[model samples]
Each structure stands twice: as structure tokens, then as C-alpha cells.
Target chain A: MASNAGVAQSRALPGPVRFITSSIGAKVVMAVSGFVLVGFVLVHMIGNLQIFLGPEAINRYGNFLQGLGELLWVFRLGLLAALIAHVASAARLVILNQSARPINYSHNDYVQVKFAARTMPISGIVVLAFIIFHLAHFTGGKVQPELFHFQDELGQHDIYAMVTLGFQNWFISGFYIVANALLALHLSHGVSSMFQTLGVTAPAWRPLTHALGPVIGTIIFIGNVGIPLACSLGLVAIPAGAM
Target chain B: MHLTLHVWRQKSANDKGRLVQYEVDNISSDMSFLEMLDVFNESLIAKGEEPVAFDHDCREGICGACSLVINGIPHGPDEGTTVCQLHMRRFKDGDTIYIEPWRAKAFPVIRDLIVDRTAFDRIQQAGGFITINTGGAPDANALPIAKTEADLAMDAAACIGCGACVAACPNASAMLFVGAKVSQFLHLPQGHPERARRVKAMVEQMDAEGFGNCTNHYECMAACPKEIDVRVIAELNLEFMKAKISGRE
Candidate 1:
């Protein structure tokens, strides 16, 4: 133990990777990747909200995105990388945390710790499964190909009709509601903790930053769940012949 | 008042430990928790049994020597108070109390209700102090510091190096302790010269000690005997990022 005394610890690796494997450095990675994913969720929610306007509005929005060609793939690939990094970092931290306490306490108690904070890993896993299922159901056109075929007289894909039709099924609508709710629950803790990890935690900024997660999470939940709820309730009628 | 105690009894560092229950009667409410333990141990000594062993010093709470997870909460029920300061009145007349040692990979149990905390010392040695010496005590107002910054530094300085934060944290993270030590220096010019190198070395040593990472649960702040704010951890994070980004060793 005395062999390394008075010497600065040797760091073999040079760039960001060296630090990222450290305790706090991994948290920074989680925060940065979380930022990317949260932004994507917000924009995705807002974009999908266009469905409330009409089929033309949302269908045109889809056409515009599909029209991006290679650029869209760039965005998709970038987002996928962020997802992979976020999950990998979270898994690493989870294992480290579990091993930190090899012995169990006879009695466990919590003071001022939030429920959302405690369930982060479970909520994260559920949300990840929802994302994969969502992508397969929507983008890959694999879940329900019949609904995926909805199109307008312009012969372009009608995403509004496609989505509304997909949610018309009771089982699918229920799953969407449950998944979106857990996503909000996940965000309610993730958003606030993200700021702390990024070091945006000045005391003066506590009120605003602490509330950011639950507030933004609720808004996203309302926006996303409203679409599916409206579809199941027949509030958003199927476009004339597209369904 | 009579009390039932479930105390963890470990023979040595390698021995597996468990809660052994005992009953004590005629306890006074005015006795401090440690005093009550003293009474309990005396009874066991009279009965020719191995008495319980616990760590304590100064009994007034500043030393950070006493550690006990009383009824699952570190340092007992009182907020911003250490175990030595916990009085018997806090519990009911016939309450059952569970006492355990600080449980963490970095803090191995040395005996019953006592764990080795030299990992903290090693982290401190890694770089928890100012290397520069001012030669002697300086005159008041020699180097004026802003009131707010001074208060903030003192707030971080109030940490007594208690392991309650780690004991209370679900992850057993030592972020609050390290943050307090690092942050006390961060707000002053005395800490400026070696700031980058200090945070890096201390954090590296902390990780090497196998302490867990902070997840901002704020459990440490609640369990802290000093009630050290969680913002120091944010400051530590910021400083660490700066050091790494600036290519400091």
C-alpha cells in the first residue's frame, strides 16, 4: 500500500473514455445521453400533437420526415447510439450500486426519498421495452400491417389514420396508456436528476430544476396519452376511406 | 422504561454477523443512547456474557466517532444529530430498537457495531487538504472573503466525516462526505491553486475504495448529522468535470 505513496495516480487511457468509466464520469455520460433522449421525446410528442388538426396536417408531417431520406437515417442512428449509451451506463451504475452494499441491513428506512427515484431502474426497463415495441408497431409496420396501410386519395401514407386505427384496439390502447404513464413516471425523476448530474444544481435554481421533471413529464403524458385516448373514445374519427 | 434491543453482534472482521436480541428493564428516559448501551453492557458483564462493543468519543456529537443504525435510520431518529446525542426519551416506554453497524463494502466491520473507516482517511490523504501553508494563524480580515462564500464554505466544512450518509444511501455512496471536503476548499482562494488536481485525485481514490456513485437521491443530505446540503455534490461534479475537461492530472 505504501508503494504508490506521494505519487499521482497513473491514468493509462487518454480521452473522455478514461473518465467515463469513473463513478461520477459515468453519471455525466448518463446525463448527456438522457438529455438527447428527453429532447427527442418532447419533439416527438409535439410533432404527433399535429394529429389533432387533421389527417392532412399529420400526413404531410410524416411525408416531410420521410422525404428527408438519408438525413432521417442520420437522426435515427444518432438517437439509437444515445439510447445504447444511456442504457449501458445505467446498467453499469446499477451493478456498482448493488455491490456497494454486499451485506443487507436488518431494517431499512427512507427519509425524504421519493418513490420515483427508487423505481428508476424498473421504470427504465419498462420504458425501454415500450420503445422497442412502439418502433416495431409503427416504423417497422410489423405489429399491425393492416392499420399501417391506411392512405389518402393523394396515395401517400396517412399517419393520422394509421395511428388512430392502431389505437382503436382495446389491448393496444391499454398498453399505450400504461407505457406512456410509466414513461412519465420515469421522466418525473430522470429530468431532475439529470440536472444534478450535469452540475446545474445551484441552490437558487433548486425550485425550478427540481420541478422540471414532474412538470415536463406530466405535459408529455397528457399530450401523448390524449391522442390514444381520443382514438379509443371515437373523438378522433377514422378518415373516410383510409381506415 | 423497559426496552428490547436487537443488536448486531459480529465476533471479528471475517465473522458473519446477525442481530441478537436482549431485554433491558428500568431504563431512564434522560439517559443518552450510549449511556443506555453502557447500562445494558454492564448487565451482560454481570451475567458473565461477552458484552457488546461500540465506538464512541467526546459524546457531544462533534467527533463523528459514534456510528449506529438505530431502527434502520443512521444516527437514529434525530435529524442533524449523531448517535451519541440520541436520548432515550425519543423512544417509547416499551419500544423495540434495532441497532446495526454502517454497512458498506468500503467499511468492513472491525467488531460488533464498529466498522473500519480508514477508506475515508485514505481518500483524505489522496487530497482532501490544502497543500500550501500560510506559516501560522493569520490576523482577522487579512484576506477578506465574500460573506456568502464564507458561509457556504463553512457549511461544507461542518461535515464531521460521519459515515451516516453512506449507511443511509441505498447505493452506499460517499459523495456527500467527499463533496463536503472538496467543496469547503472550492469556495476559497486557498483551494484555487490545487483545485483541479485535488478533486481528481480524491475522486479516483474514492472510486478505488469501491464506494458507489451518487444518483442525487438526496438521502445523504437527510441522514447527515450536520445536515450538509446536497449542492456540495453538484459542486464536486462541476469541479470534476472542469478538471477532466482542462486535461488536468
Candidate 2:
């Protein structure tokens, strides 16, 4: 009996493994990866905001990142891993959640469910598509190489020219604006939800916890959208020397 | 008062149910929701038709047997009140109420508003207990539990296993129910010995039962008859993390 029990135990998932495999486990993975991605977005926005400081500052920033070289690739790989984990876990969770309720309630109502929470998957997909387009436009230089390929006066990759040229196009600027709006919605739900999933929510901190999502989401939205808006409106122009 | 109710009706577990409309006339405003159902059932019996089946015991709302989703809100529009305690006065005359069973893949419809909530019992059986010595009752003060902890335990203990939290959840998650059971024990000294093991066993059982995960929508808390806090879910997650980290399955 003892041997049989031991064999069965070995066949079954161990405690930690089982914990990560469960629904809550998937949620925890999404939450943690979301935190990493949120941090990246904030830093990326701060870096991009250097456009206000003129061509040299922005080009210097780009050069600094390029200077990291192989280490930069390592950072890129880490961000990629976080994105993949977040997406995969969320996809699995969505499937499991849909399967849990085979029948639909004809008159389902939303009492406390927010618009942001209801549209998380939709916003997440939009943000994902935007991320791919963004990479193609800037990182890969494959979208419009003619405009994307330029060098600043200091012989650095002309990020300022690329950003201005890209956003000056009405369609591209509009897409960026819309995508950032959706990202705001996604973050509004996702930020506070991460705290809840990680078990950091306490009754004493309810107000602060609830406000975290919307606050961060608004800041990101304003910061990101401000760039494209300023670019299209000619408020921030590519410096003459840099072009 | 006259009211129209679109109550869900199914003959058995395998039967595909649909909404069957019934009209109840001359219902007093003071009549409880279940009492109104009793009147309708009487009329059905007189007409030689099958009475609508539903679960209800201790009609005072403590039994947790009453499970009904009225107009998309579990237990009716009022917060913190069970279906058994809901009165007809809350609705206007000539109102049409949409009534349905607690819809979940795990909790199948047995008949009309009755769902097989035995899944909850199975989850409870997995770990919702403490090993006790078979002897005379110990003194209440012997455990030396802090008043705050005792209060929190009682708050969680108020869960009646009615499955309202699951019904109210968009994902059909039983997290609140499982969290309540785990929290109730976690706060008490008697639950210390089996703390890690209990959380692991119960969480494993919950996953095996195929309930959806919580996404912090807070609908379950709003729809809960006992008003169980969603924070308990955080507690459950914390306990599960500690158990896994401690390597104590």
C-alpha cells in the first residue's frame, strides 16, 4: 500500500508545480509579468519624452541604448519573455474562464464590473497589435525605410527624424493615439488587478490600491499621446541640423 | 398585486431547460419571494401540472439552500439579502422578473432553480476541517484567540455555502467561497496545525473542480448574500504562496 501510494504521489503534480498550474497560478504569472511590462512602459515613455529636449538629447539617448549592444539584446530578450508569459497565461485563463460557463445567462447584468475590466481582452489584443506595428515602424525600419533611415549631425541614428516623420502621417498618428487610448483602458484594470492577484490588497489600502490603475493609466496615456499629438501639430519639430 | 415571472424549468439533469412564464395574481406585498413561489406551486398542483422545482430550507435565509438569480442579480436586487428573505414589496405590480438557476459548468441545473452544489461539499471535504481529539469540549477561552482574529474568522465563517458568489461571478469562479472556507480556518488557532496542508489540499481540489479564476471584478462580493469580502481571496493566495514556498504540500 505504501509503495502504491508513493508511486501515485510521484505521478501527480507536486505542490509548487500544482500551484503554478492552477487557475490562480496563471493569474499570478499574468500579474507579475504585467508588473514588469508596466515598468518597461513607464521607463520607455520617460526615455521617449526626451524629444522635448531637442535632437541632440534624443539622439544621444538612442546612441546610449545602442551603446549597450549585446547587453541591450539581453534586456530585449527579458522584455520579450515577460510579454510572452503575460500573453500565454492570459490566453489560457481566458479559455478556462469561458469553459467554466458553458451556458450563457440571457440577461447578464454588470453591477460593479467596470468597462475597463469588461474589455481587458479586447484592449490587450489591440495593445499587442500596436506593439508589433510599433516595432516594425521604429525598431525594424521595415515599414517605411526611406523616412526611418536618417542620421543626426553627430552621426547617431536620427530617432528624432524617424519619430517626427512617422507621426506626421495622419493615419499613423491616429492609430497611435487610438492604441494608446486602449492601452490606458487596459492598464486601468490591469494595474490594480495585479496587486489583487499578488495578495497585496488590504482593507486599509483599498482606496490607494483602487486608484493605482487609473492613475498610472492616465499618466501613460497622456505621456504617450502627447508625443504623437505634438509631432502631428508641429509643436515639436526635428531640428534643422539633425535632419 | 400581479407579477409575471420567467422562471427557468428543466425536467432533470440531462434536460435542456428554458424560460417558462407564469403569472401570479393577488400576491401580497408582504409575501417573501419563496412564499410567492409556494403560491404559484399550489396553483400548479391544482391544475394537475408539475410544480416548479427549487431548493429552499430554513426559509429564513440561514440554510443557504435558496439559490435563485432574479433579474440578473443573485438573490434579487437588494444587497446582502438572500432570496428567501426577499419580499415581493421590493417589486412593483405588473413587473416582469427574469429568474434563472445558478449557472456554472460545475453546478449543473437539477431542476428549475435548483443546482447541484455538491461540488462545494467536495471542495469542503478536501480540507475544510481540523483534526480534533475525541473528548469533552475544551473551554472557549483556552485557545486564546485575539478578538480581531476571532471577528475576522466569524466574518468568513458567515459563508453559508449557497454558491451565490459563484453565481454572481462573470467567470463562474468559486474563489470567494473557497477563500471564505480557508480564511475561516486560517484565523483560528485550531487551524494552525494543518494550515499549509489545508490550503494546498483545498486549492488543488478547487482547481480540479474546473471553476474559473478570479479577475477581481468584485461582482461576487456585490452579489454575495453573506457579503463575504473579496479580500479573502487575497488571503487564500497568500496562504497558497506561503505553503508552496515552505515546501509543505
User: Over the stretch A1-243, how does candidate 2's per-residue lDDT look in tens digits?
Assistant: 232343245338765566566767778888989999999999999999999897889999999999999999999999999999999888888898899899978778768899999899899999999999999989999887887669877788999888888888989999999999999999999999988888874699888888999999999999999999999999998656643
Predict model 2's lDDT versus the native: 0.89
For model 2, the DockQ equals 0.52
Which pairs clash (backbone N, Cα, C closer than 3 Å) in model 1?
none
Interface RMSD of each: 3.0, 5.0
Question: Residue by residue across B80-150, what tens digits does model 1's lDDT show?
Answer: 99999999999999899999999999899999999999989999998999877667888888988999999
Question: How well is each residue in A1-243 modelled by candidate 1, as lDDT tens digits?
Answer: 531432234366555766898888999999999999999999999999998998888999999999999999999999999999999999999999999999979898889789988898998998899999999998999999987887786878978878888888989888888888989998999999888888875788999999999999999899989989999998897757644
Q: Lowest summed lDDT over 10 consecutive residues: which window, candidate 1 chain B?
A: B131-140
- Candidate 2 residues lying further than 4 Å off, grouped into runs, are A1-11, A14-17, A239-242
Q: Which stretches of candidate 1 lie over 4 Å from their true place?
A: A1-10, A239-243, B134-139
TM-score of 2: 0.96
Q: Tens digits of per-residue lDDT for model 2 on B1-249?
A: 899989898999999989989888989999999999999899999999999998999998798999999999899999999999999999999999999999998898988789989888878887999989899988877779889899999999999999989998989999999999999998998888999988877777777676888998999999988999988999888888888788775
Cα lDDT for residue B189, model 2? 84
TM-score of each predicted structure versus truth:
0.97, 0.96
